[model samples]
Target: MSAPVSTGVIPELFRGLFDDAAVFPPGNLPVAEAVPAHRVHRTAWYAEAVGPLLCGAGRLGELAAVPPTSGAVGGAQEAGATPLRVGLVLPGGSAELAPALAAAAPFELAGVELATRDAAEAVAELDRLLPPHVPAAVELPRELLRGDGLDAVLDVLVDSPYRAKFRTGGLVAEAFPDEDELAAFLTGCALRGLPYKCTAGLHNAVRHTDPETGFEHHGFLNVLLAARETDRAAAAAVLAERDGEVLAKAARSLTDRQVTVIRNSFTAFGTCSIAEPLGDLAALGLLSSPDPLPQEDR
Candidate 1:
């Protein structure tokens, strides 16, 4: 990604909004390569708008082997030392989670995102395995929504300390939820005051259909704006919108108060490539003059 030209500053609403998923699909960057890049993002001008580096709980051993380097920001202990804020992605079961969390106890535990069977069981497992202090999100597969279980799941999470998660896209066509489904989920979260995070398929700044795969992907901007709308239909419209300018206009029009409400509900989404969203935000006039990549990093 090219350097962001000096123009607009990132709105307070967007600060610390994106979590780096460089180790995941699409980008599939190896741990060695992803660590240095995440370090750069921590020190970048728009660092405030970035979140933790997401790693699979299974890869803790590989990541532990990498030594801390210079330029890591946030909560590092010393100059030139990397202070990592990490979120561990848990698999469908809890067998490996305990050891992984133990290994990562030395660093800042930003949160955990786990794949579970459904909402009720997820909440039960989270309570069983994770301490209340650690923020965790459970990803309920979209199929669960087909039955009345979705509402039950939402009610369970709304009453608990844990947050809800929705998968916006995947490697295959079935992974992306349709507009109505996404809008319903967002509406549910907004109404219940349940903050949520999204993962997968949000690769760019605006909504677009992939010509190669022909799958429609949701734009992070669309999701952000939609979360602000209380009207389910209106939020769904934003989710289905294909025009980037329209989405940008809506985003630019948000007030500080509105931004707060939206951020409180929408939270952050995981992306495999941080640079892609940063670049897109810059183009949309949302990110003002992002700090240039450090000379050494470049």
Candidate 2:
């Protein structure tokens, strides 16, 4: 793999942790990487926070009702660009909102990711009533994104043959699938053709086992470079190997090629540690520049 330029990586890379999140450090990122994907999603409060920059109609029921003219997304479609995906964040137990949310139906925003089992069912049921008007996808809970996840949730709506048909998108939550468990998930995905974005605990650039905590940090940077054609069991070997020498070399160099491999995954870099975001961005050469405008301008 070759290193990618900051300009090339930023467009798709620029998405806030959640639309409602107000934690972005006032800094310049490539305009593209700083924005979310075609079908954007965010916590319910995202609109309350950065609603202006977001071109949605407003929160419709539980979903953000975005008119094509107002969103950052519609321009591409008009230009004959490949259709972009748009979706809403379905809260953990927003079942009651399903009917109303679906009312915005045949509407954009790739299906919804449910926060809980109950919410998953609601999205599934809504998909049923959607009448096939639009494409629908259901985000699997972190559990179903893991090894054996397909079977575990085979009976659940996340695996439903009907409305909740497991959409391809997945997320890795380090808590459930510790590094060891994560390896299984990655390997499984490789075998079954699954790729995902990880959230919350993966801000680091390497796969390291905290000496004190004895747990591994779930950064996909290492995985992107390390996963192989024989990845079905690669996770166990790579993670268990815990070769500080190899990962250390990669991080120290932070070469463009290495960063590009990781960025290619479109997987998120996250952590409870604030440095995680800056570190990943810095690794990608997404340098931080002071905001020219007053803090209020943001």
Query: Best by TM-score, which number?
Result: 1
Model 1 / residue 99 / CA error / Å: 2.3
**Candidate 1 off by > 4 Å:** 1-8, 71-82, 293-298
Please provide, for model 1 over 1-298, each residue's C-alpha lDDT reduced to its tens digit, 9 standing for 90 to 100.
Answer: 1222323365777777889898898878888878778777766676766788898877877776666654343332455443578888986555556787787765577898877776666677678878667899877778886557778778889988888889999999989998888988998889899999999999688889898999999999999989977787998898989888888888888888999999999889998877778778778877667455233221
Give the Å shift of residue 247 in candidate 2: 4.6
Give the alpha carbon lDDT tens digit for every residue of 1-298 in model 2: 0111233222222333212211222222222332332123221211111111221223332222222333334322334222333344444444533553544443344334334454345555655554454433344565555545554443343244322222211132234355455555554444433334444434455556556656556444455444432354555565444454565454446566545543443333222233344345455554232322112112
In order of listing, the candidates' clash counts read 3, 18
- lDDT of each model, Cα atoms only? 0.78, 0.38
State the TM-score for model 1.
0.89
TM-scores of the models, in the order given: 0.89, 0.46
